[model samples]
Target: MAKSPYPVINPGGGPMGKVIIALVLIAIVTLVIKYPSDAARWVHGLGSVIDGLVDFFRTLFG
Candidate 1:
């Protein structure tokens, strides 16, 4: 018997995975298009929070 050249690590979740991914991509695009400013502010706030945490850690250690 011959073995498959490309083995199937995950045999199932083929079409379903594609569909879920497509839906998620569509949602993200729609959000970016509809709420451009809101999205930008949200991302900026996230960056600020991360920077504050880094500063706090540096002050604590050094």
Candidate 2:
């Protein structure tokens, strides 16, 4: 029996799925790297995105 190289649970998943995630992460990272504003803006944007989820959950629970 020839064992299939095709993964049942793909480590990369599909091409599009990986690409979309990579792009979003890249966008945020690029914002950090090349923003015209101060470091505060970059830090705030990154912090907000990460904290946004937590704030949402707090509001939902509260």
Best by TM-score: 1
Per-residue lDDT over 16-50 for candidate 1, one digit per residue giving the tens place of the 0 to 100 score:
77777789999988989999998899899999999
Per-model clash counts, in order, read: 0, 0
Under the 3 Å rule for N, CA and C atoms, how many clashes does model 2 have?
0
**What is candidate 2's local distance difference test score?**
0.81
- What are the per-residue Cα lDDT tens digits for candidate 2 across 1-62? 99888847556678977888899999877876787476577678989898999999999999
What's the CA error at residue 1 for candidate 2, in Å?
Answer: 26
TM-score of each: 0.56, 0.39
Candidate 1 weakest ten by summed lDDT: 8-17
Model 1 off-target regions past 4 Å?
Answer: 1-23
